[model samples]
Target: MPKGVYKLPEIKNEPIKSYAPGSPERQALKQKLVELSKGGLDVPMIIDGKEIRTGNLSDIRPPHDHQHLLGHYHQGDKTHVQMAIDAALKAKPAWEAMHWESRAAIFLKAAELIAGPYRYDFNAVTMTGQSKNAFQAEIDAVCELVDFYRFNVRNMYELYGMQPNSAPGIWNRTVWRPLEGFVFALTPFNFTSIAANLGGAPALMGNTVVWKPSKTAVYPAHLIMKVLKEAGLPDGVINLVYVGGKEAADVIFNHREFAGLHFTGSTGVFNGMWKTIAGNMDKYKSYPRIVGETGGKDYVFADVTADAKQVATALTRGAFEYQGQKCSAASRAYIPATLWDGVKKYMESDLKSIRMGVPEDFTNFVNAVIDEESFNKLAKAIDDAKKSPDAEVVMGGNCDKSKGYFIEPTVILAKKPDYITMREELFGPVLTVYIYDPEKLDETLDILDSSTDYALTGAIFSTDRVNIEKMTSRLTHTAGNFYINDKPTGAVVDQQPFGGGRASGTNDKAGSVFNLLRWVSPQTIKETFVPATDYMYPNFLED
Candidate 1:
């Protein structure tokens, strides 16, 4: 382990309890889920008030030790996809015609429900299904989702203006409205808030959504649907499906009614979606809107003037939190050569102090990865990095998959900033560190800029005002969410708009007015108070 890094808190080991099957606390959850299952709330593939369930089904497993079964979800196929498109077509007219205030009120109620009695269920599913610790799960499943709901209500009114235009004896006005067709949302497993934001945002903006959530997060997605239904959202406003990547791609790419795609996942998947959308452009009903937030290789730069303790804490927490699965997780660190020795000592000591264990324990700071596949991926990456001549594992390259997908928190010291370990997105409890000359800050920034195709998030730590200004300005193009004294994670909704640019994504900043605008299509409507009395008004005829 690295020298002076603090150990994470320890967790108590005990048999995991199911919060949904029979517990008293789960009575409401069970009733809600059962209600949803029995058609109290609508499922996916409903068109024109008709419920269409495709025979295809798939099992979804909670990642807490990978032994718990969350339940099964309908796997939407081509026919179901078409049905969803048709349903959106049927509902769009009436939904869009409703007063915006009514739509906003539904979303506000949903937020209230999430913050109320259902908060625990949301957090529970997030912890078990996504393998996140309590704090991380709470932030993802509760706080962020609530914030998005509240923020976007205001954003809707802001993005869609209501002012009227006037001229000499003439009046005109313009209105922003939802797209004419269905919007598809492909969400990731790392964040449950994304499921709501991607689908709910569009739905609130008067666009019906066909959402395919990650199989690992099915339970939470279902709960979100329950909350929406209980909050008084009409049936067919948002449809939920659970399927693998190929199935989702088939539905998204081939459907003519497919108006757009909102995606968050791997770069390979994002690129593939882009290609598929482009290839089938001629088949779509209208020009499709593609908004995505893909993979990221974010970094944290530590200058000699930076506080050693603060830098250590940020680097350690950013890299190990959520098993380092977040898109904005700090995967690499660049330290000034002059402070490398001191920073290394501090990080090592702190790392040694970090404790890791199962999720139920409130004191447990780190939990398992999402599943065995992710664990294997992290293992392979660590093995490859260990073999590199210029790199050494300072701490944590161990994995025990006998019971759970557990990997020790890991750190690597690199000889160069351009090392392979520093260039890729590890997406695990692993971080790579590089030492560079402070005077070559520009050179360092250039290397980082070109190292990876991702431009999601990055941070710089320096007390020098000149250095801070210079680095911020020069590296502005390198990241979407930039930070000075803070870590890349914990992005608050109202304060910092999320999402990325360049290969990372479309730069549609989530949690802001801009993100809400993506779901709406602005239309200019003009009306004249008086009809034209004459078609021809020549200069000689003018009186």
Candidate 2:
């Protein structure tokens, strides 16, 4: 068992009631749906003016305690994907033809709905389904959704006014337009806000979407659709499908009408999708757009000059937040040899204070992992690290899945910079700490850069302006999102643009204005005072 330097607060366990569909809560959800629909019936799937249902079903469970069943949702298949495509295909003409103000209004209302009473259910489903603590769940399901919607809309308005001139009489205006076909939103289980951002980004920009949320997060995604519907978004504008990845991928890649993809998940899956998209490039009706945020070996670097206490606190939250399941989770850390002992001591002390229990228990800092499979994977990774020749498991390396998918917050001390714990993306509450010489800052930075194929997020602690500047510039390619004097996790939506380069997936940053660009296609509209009907322009002809 792992030892702690301080005693953790004892967390009280609370029994939460199972959430059933058609209950008071469900009725409230239905009422929200009715309000958002403005009296239109809650159609499961709208395909070319028709309401279609696959009739397949799947049960969604709350991961916090695993005893509660969230609800049963319709599990869509290929036919459903096709139906969504057909709806989008039908709606695209009219939606694209509508004024931009109309399209923007739908999303603006969505942002307001998310900030209102819908916030409660959104928070509840996120807390239950994803096992996120109250604060974390609120930040994701409510705050982040609001931020993405508000910021994307505000930025798109700015993008509209941005124009470059060509000549005195002739002027060129660049307009960003949505792709001609449907955008497929494939989301991950980690953050509920991703469903809103991925689906809303496209829908806000006049493109309809077929969203395939992770099975683990279907309930929360369903509630999101509820909110959108309540917000008065037109039918066929946003289609939510609870389906397996293979079936969704078949529908997405095989359909010639598939226009773009907005994905967030594993690198292997992203690569596979890329290959499929590439192979089908010839058969595509249009050049499809693909934007993804994949794997990350995000890190936090603590030098001798760093504050040990702050590092400890940041690590506690960064490494164990959401059971370290986020792509931005801090999986690795580099500590200077001069402060390694103190840092370790602080970490050990802080680890004692980390209360692990159910999410509803507001005081509990850590909750169960997403499911049994994740728990097993995290446990095995910890065991492998413990057995590695160059590393020692200094803290937490245990699992108690009999109750729920729970694992102790783990910490590993690496004997060398090249240890396996430092090299891989362990998406769990496992932190690998490596001590290095403070004098070899350049070498340490290089080592950090080369240690992982993923370049999603990284952070450094330093008071020296020159060193910080140098490190920031040199390690630009190390992560798309970089931080100074802060933990790599807990990225804000408006300020920090998320996503990474290389194997970490697309560089389309998630939070800010950059993410909105992914859903739009730039079209240059040129106007001339004189009607030049001839093909040859003045530039091409000798003046």
TM-score of each: 0.88, 0.88
Tens-digit lDDT track of model 1 for 216-249: 7766877888888888788777877655678767
TM-score of 2: 0.88
Per-residue lDDT of 250 in model 1 = 81
CA shift at 263, candidate 2, in angstroms?
A: 0.6
Model 1 CA deviation exceeding 4 Å by range: 1-59, 74-76, 162-165, 530-543
Candidate 2 residue lDDT tens string, 229-265: 7677777887777667899888789888888999999
Scored by Cα lDDT, where does model 1 land?
A: 0.78
Compared with the true structure, all predictions reach lDDT values of 0.78, 0.78
**Model 2 alpha-carbon miss at residue 219, Å:** 1.0
